[model samples]
Target chain A: MYRQGWLGWLFVAPALLLTCVFFLWPLALVGWMSLHNWPLIGRIRWIGIANYRAMLNDPIFLQSVRFTLTYAAAITPTIFVVAMALALLANGDRRFVGLFRTLWFMPTAIGLSTASVLWVWMLNGQVGIFAAIGRALGLVETDIPYLDSGTNAMIAACSMVVWKTAGFNMVLLLVGLQSIPSELHEAARIDGAGAWQNFRHVTLPLMRRTLKLALFLSITGSLLAFDQFYIITRGGPQNGTISMVYWIYNNAFSSFRTGYAAALSLVLLAVVLLASLAQFMLFRDREDA
Target chain B: MSRNTAAWLYYAACLAVTGVFVFPVLWVLICSLRPAAESALPPAWIPSTLSLENYETLRRVGAGLWRYVGNSVAVSVGSALAVAAVAALAAFGFSRFRFAGRGVAFVLLLAAIMVPFQTVLTPLFIVLRAVGLHNTLLGLGIVYTTFHLPLAIFLMLTAMGAVPRTLDEAAMLDGAGALTVLLRVILPLVAPSLATVVLINFIAGWNEFLAALILMTDQSNYTLPVMLVTVTFGYMGTVDWGALQAATVLTMLPVLALTLCFQRYYVQGLVAGATKG
Candidate 1:
C-alpha cells in the first residue's frame, strides 16, 4: 500500500479536468456574470450588484419563488405519502410484488416533458379520458377543466409530478424497509407493540436516513421543476404556475437577460444549499438527541 | 378483522395502487393506437378501430421523429459511456490511492451534485458556443457526462470500495499495471455498479430537458424530449393529439425497455445513488 506514483493522477485527470472545465468554471462564470449586465447580443457591461438589486424588487421573480415553493411544499407530501404506502404494501415477500414494483417504477423512466404531453392529452377538456371517465361515472355533467383555472392547474401539475416521481421514492423507501431486520419487528411484537406502535417506534426511526434523503431529493426536484409546468400549464392561468427555474429559463433564453438569470441562478443555488444544510443539521441533531 | 381478511385487504390495496399508477400510461397506449379521427369521447377502453395511423403520421410529421430518436440515442449512449469510463477511473483513484488532495477533490466533486444544472447554464452556454459546440450532439453529450459525473463517480466509488484491496495488490504482484488491474480485475468485479451507472446516465441523458433545450437550438439536433415539446407546442393552433400521443409513446419506449430489462439493477442503482450518496 506504500507504493505511490503518478498513476493515481493519471487515472483521475480526465474526470478532474472535465469537472474543472464544465462544472467549476461554469459555476465561477455564473458568479461573475451575476455582477454584470450580460445581454445575449450586446457588449457586456459591468454593472455591479444591479441584477441582484433588481431581483429584490421584481414582483414576477418574487412570485416565481413563492409559486415554486408552494409547488414543492404541496408535491413533497403527496409524493411521500403515496410512496410510503406503496413501500409498505410492497415490503413483504408477496407473490407478484416484483411485478407491482416494476409497474410502479415504470413511470420514472418516462421523461417529464413526455409525461406532461401524455397527461395534457389525457386531461384535455373535450376528449380526455379523465373527462370521459368522469362523465361515464356520472361524476360531472361536462368535461372537467383540470388545467383551466389557477388552482386546478396547480393541482393538475402536482398530480402529474406525484405520478411521475412517487415511484422513485417508493423504490428508495422499499430498500429502507427491506433492510430493516425482522428481528427488530419481532422484538417489538414481543414487547406487545401493536402495528401502529411498531411502525412508529421501530420502522420510522430505523428509516430516518432514507426518509431524509428522499425528502431532500423530492423537495429539491420540485423546486427545480420546469418540464411539467412548462409543458402542461405553460405557467398559465395568469402566469400563476411559473416556477423559479421556468422564470430563470424565460429570462435567460427568451428575454436574453443573461445577467439577471445568472443572478437568479446564484440565489437559487444559495437557497438550495442552505435548505439542504439545514435539513442535514436537523437530522444530525435528531440523531444526536 | 381476521388474519385472512387482513391479507386480502392488503392484496386489494396493492392492486388498487398498481392500477392507479399504471392506468395513465395504459390509457395513453390505447389512445396511441386509436384511429386519428375517432372522438375517443365515451372513453374507448378498448379501441373499436385500432390503427397505426397516428404512428405513421408521427413518422412523417415535422422534423421527422426518427431523427430525434437517433439524436437522443447518440447523446444518451455517448454520455453514459463517457461518464462510466471517466467515473470508473476516478473512482478507482479515490478508492485505492492515498493521493494528495484526494479528500478535497472528492468533496469538491460531491458538491457539484447539489448544484443544479440551471446554475451553470449561462456560463456553460457561452463556453459551449465559444468552443463552437453550440448545436452539436457531441457538446450536449459532454455536458450530460460532466453533469452526471458526480453521482456516477460517487456510486462507482462505493462499488470500488466494496472491492477488497487485496485484489489490486494481488494484481500488481502478478506484474499487472494499474490500468491492467483496473480493466482486468476490479472492473469485472464491479460490473453491476458499472451497469447501474450506465443505465442511470442513459435514462438521465434521455430525459434531460432544460440543457438540451437551451444548448441544441437547431431542430435537426434536438433530442426526443425537446423535439416532442417543440412539435407538440409548435402547432399551437391545432394540436394533433393522436400524433402527440404516438410521439410520447415513442419517446418512452426505450427507457421502458431498459427499465424492464434491468429492473433489479435499476432499483439498486437508484436506491444506492439516493440513500447512500
Candidate 2:
C-alpha cells in the first residue's frame, strides 16, 4: 500500500464529491422537500407532514401501491422459475449450450421502453401477430384487443417483462449453477438418484444463496417497473395498471406536485428497504435452520 | 430410449426454446424490411416483398432518426468514458492507499448502490434545474456516470487489488511517481476490466429510458428510447408500425454489436459482480 498520506484522499476526492452531490445530497434534500408545499415554479411553503397525511386519503396512490404489489407478486415468481429453468438448460458445456445461452440472453440488450413499444405494436388487435395467429388457428373471429382492458394490459406487460429480464437472471443463475462441483452430481447418480431426485436434494440445497440474490433482484425490479406500464397501458382503464413508480412520476412531473412526489419517494424508499430487510431475515432463518 | 436419441431430443427442446426467444426479434427485423403495406396486413413469417420504405419513414419521424441516434450515442459514450475515468481513480485510491477512513469511505460508497435512482428523481431534477443543466445532454451524461460509479468502483478495486503490489513498488523504487505508475504500469494490467466497465456502463446508459424521458422534455433533445415512444403515438394516435419497427431495430443495433464483440468481458463483469455481492 502507498503511504502517500493525503494523496490517497486526493485520488478519492472526485468520486466522493460526485456521490455526495448527486446521490447523498439528493437523498437529504428529498427528505426536506417532503415537508413542504414545493411546486414546479412557486415559493416553497412548509406543510409539515401534510403530504404524508394526504397520502392516507389519496385513493389513486393507495390503488397504485396495491397494484404495484400485485404486479410484483405475480412477476417475481414467473421470472425466477423461467430463469432457473434456463440456467439449468444451459449449465453444462454441451455442444449447443452456448448457442442456447446467447439466444435467450439477446433480448436483454434491448431497452425496456423500446421493448414495450415493440410489444405494444405486436399486441395490437388490428395488425398484431398475436391476433393474426389466433385467426390462423381458428381461435377467434376478430382481432383480440390486448391493451384495452386492465387484465389484458397486465398480462401483456407481464409477458413483456418476462421476455426482457428472464435472460439476465438466467445468466446470474448460470454462474451459480456452474460453481457447484460436478462430482456431487456424479455421486448422486451413482447412488441411484434420478434427475428429479438429484435436483431436489443436491441442486436446490446448494443453490440457496444464488436463489436468494436472484429473488431479491427480481422483486425490487418488479416493484420499480415504470416504462412498460407507461408505454403499454399509460395507467389507463381506470388506473388498474398504475405502478408505484408510475404514480410517483405522474405526481412529480405531470401534476407538478413536487412536495407530494418527494413524500411518495420517501415512502417508496422505505418500502424497498423493508422488503430487503424481510428477505434478509427470511434467508438468514433458512440458513440457520 | 437410446442415449443418442435422448441427446437429440434435448437438442430439439433447446432449439425450440431458442426459437421462442429469438422469434420476436427476428420477426421485427423482417417487418422492418418488408414494404409498408405488408407490415399493416396480417403478419407473415416470410416477406413476399422487401423494401426500404420503413427505413425511409423512420428517417422522417420526429427530429429525424439520425438526430436521436446522435443524441443517444453522445450521451452514452460521454457518460461511459466519464465513468471509466472516475472509477479508475477511485479504484486506485481505495486499493493502494492505507490512509485513515479508507475502509469507512469504501463501505459508504458501495452503500450508494442500494439506493435506486427512482427514489431520487425529484431532487435530482431540482438539482439539475438549480445548476442550469436540467435539459442538457451533458447533464444526463453526468447523472449516468454518478449512478454507475458505485459498482464500477467496486469492480475496479477488486481488479486492481489482484495485481501484485510488488510491481508498483518496483516502479516506485525506480523513481516513478504515483500518477506515472498508475497510468503506465497498473492500467495496462487492468485493461480487460477497464473494457468491461466501459461496456457495462455504455449498455446501461444506452438502455436507460425513464430518466432520459423525464429529464429531457424537449422533443429535439430526446434520446433513442424516448424518441421511440413519441413515434409510437405518431399520426393522430395511429402507430406507424413500419417506422416504429425500423426505429426499434436501429436502437438495438449498437448495443447488440458491442455485446457480441466483447461478450466475454460482459459476462465476466456480471458474474463477478453477482458473486462478490
Candidate 3:
C-alpha cells in the first residue's frame, strides 16, 4: 500500500499539479476576489457581499438572469427533441446512414462563431440566400432584417444552434441508440408493439442515460452561451438578447469590473451546481424506483 | 403501402432535412467566390462573375484574418498536445493504482464539467496576469488545456481501463518501465481514442471564443473565433456580413474536412468520454 501510494502520487502528480495551478487555484482566487471591491487597476478593498448584493439589486443583472434562464428553457428541449428525431432518422441500418450522419454532424464541427458569421450573411435582407430564395419562390413579398430585431434574431440564433447541434446531439444519442440491444426491439415487435410503441417501451428506457447526458450538456452549454450572441447579434436590438454570461462578460472584460464579474461567476457556478445536483437526484430517484 | 412509395417517402424526407442542414454552409462557399461589390446584393445563388477575389482579398483586409487562422492553429495544436499529455499520464495513474484521494480527484474533474466557464474567466484572468502570461499564446494555451483537461483525461482513462491490468503486471514483471509499457503497449491500443481526443480538442480549442477574446488584445494574435468577432468591427461600426461569411468559410474549411473524414473516431471518442466505455 505504501509503495502503491507513492506510485499513484507520482502518476497523478502532473494532473493534480496542473489542476491546482490552473483550475482549483484560479477558482479559489476568483472567489477571494469576489469578496472584495476589485478594480482593474487600483487597490482592492474587502467589501463582503457588496459586489454580490449590488448585482443582486442591479436591474440589468436581474434582467440578464431572467433572459439567460428563458434562453436555456427555450433552447434545451428544442435541441433534445430535434437531436432525438435526427438520431432516429439517421440510425437506420442503410448504407447511406453514414452519409446522412456526416451531413448532419458536419455543422456542429463548424465553430459556433463561424456559424454565426455564415448565418449573418445567409440571413441578410438583400443579398442573403434565404431572402433571395424566399423572394424567388414568392414565400415572402418583402425583405426582412433577420438579425435586426431581438425576437427574430434570438429565434434565428436558436435555430442556428438547433441546426448545428441536432446532428451532434443525434450523434451523441446514436451512441445511446447503438448500445441498445437489437433483440429488445425485436422482442417488443413480436409482442405486438408498433414502431412508436417499441420506441416508447424499449428504446426510451435504454436511452435514459444518454438522454440525461445530452440534456445536461445542452442545458449547461445553452446557459453559458456567449460566442453566438457575441458574434451574431452582439446581444443587440437594444440589449434584449443579452444573456447572463454575456452580461458577466461585459462587466469583467469589457467594463473592467473585476469584482462584479467574479461575484456573478460564483453565483452562476452555484446555480449550475444546484441544477446539476437536482438532475443527479432526479435521475437517481428514477433509478431507485 | 407499396415498397417504392415508402422508400421514396423516406428518401424525400432525408433529402429535405439534408437541404436544411447543408444549405447555409454551401451558400457561404458560393458567396465567397463572388466579386466584393456583387457579394453585397447579388440575388443569384451562383454569381454572374465568379472570382476567388474574397479569398485573395481576405489577405488584404485589415482584419488580419489569415493571421488569425495561423494563431488559431498554433494555440489549438499547443493546447491539444498539453491536454492530451497531462490527461494521459493522469489517466494512466488513475487506471492502475488504488490510492488515497483518487476518487476525490476524479470527482473534482468530473464536477469541473458542470462549472460554467464564464464563472471561472475572472479568476483565470487574474491568474494569467499574475503569471505574466496574459495576451500571449502560451497563456491562451494554458487556459484552454486546463479547461479541457477533464474531458481529455476522462477519455484516456476510459480507454486505458479497457486494457487489462494483467498485461501491465506481466510487462512489469518482465522488467518493463511504466513509461515504456505505457508508450509501447498501452498507447497503441488506444490510438483511436487518442485520435478522437485530438480531433475533438483541436476543434474545441480552435473555436473557443471567450478566453481567446478576453486574453488576446492584439489583432496579430487573434484566434479564428476572435477574428470572426472582428469582422463585425468597422469605421461606421456596421458589421461586414459578406466579408464575414467569406472568412467564416475559409476558417471552417479545414476543420470541416477533418471531422467529415475522421467522424468515426469522433463517435468513439465521445462514447469513451461519456460512458467511460
Best by the lDDT measure: 2
**Residues A57-113, model 1: lDDT tens digits:** 998899999998898889988899999988888888878998888899899888888
Candidate 1: regions farther than 4 A off: A2-4, A190-192, B39-42
Give the CAPRI rating of model 2. medium
Interface RMSD after interface superposition, model 1: 1.9
* Per-residue lDDT value at A70 in model 3: 87
Clash pairs, model 2 backbone: none
Worst 10 residues of 3 chain B by lDDT: B268-277
Per-residue error (Å), model 1, residue A133: 1.5
Cα displacement (Å) at residue A169, model 2: 1.7
Tens-place lDDT digits, model 3, residues B1-277? 8988988888788888899999887878877787877766745756788887776656766656567777888999998888888888888888877788888888877667767567888888888888899889998998888888888988887789899887887788888877788898899998877888788888889878788888897778888777766775543477655576678887789889888788788666655655541
lDDT tens digits by residue: candidate 2, A21-122: 888888999999999999989899999999999999999999999999999999989999899988988988889688789889988878899899988888
Q: What's the TM for model 2?
A: 0.97
* The candidate that achieves the highest TM-score relative to the unseen native structure: 2
Q: Which candidate wins on DockQ?
A: 2
> Which parts of model 2 have CA positions greater than 4 angstroms off?
A282-289
Q: State residue B171's C-alpha deviation in candidate 1, in Å.
A: 2.8
| lDDT tens readout by residue for model 3, A152-237 | 87888898899888887888898889998899999998899999999998999888878888887787777788877876787887
Task: Supply the TM-score for candidate 3.
Answer: 0.93
The DockQ-based CAPRI class assigned to model 3 is medium
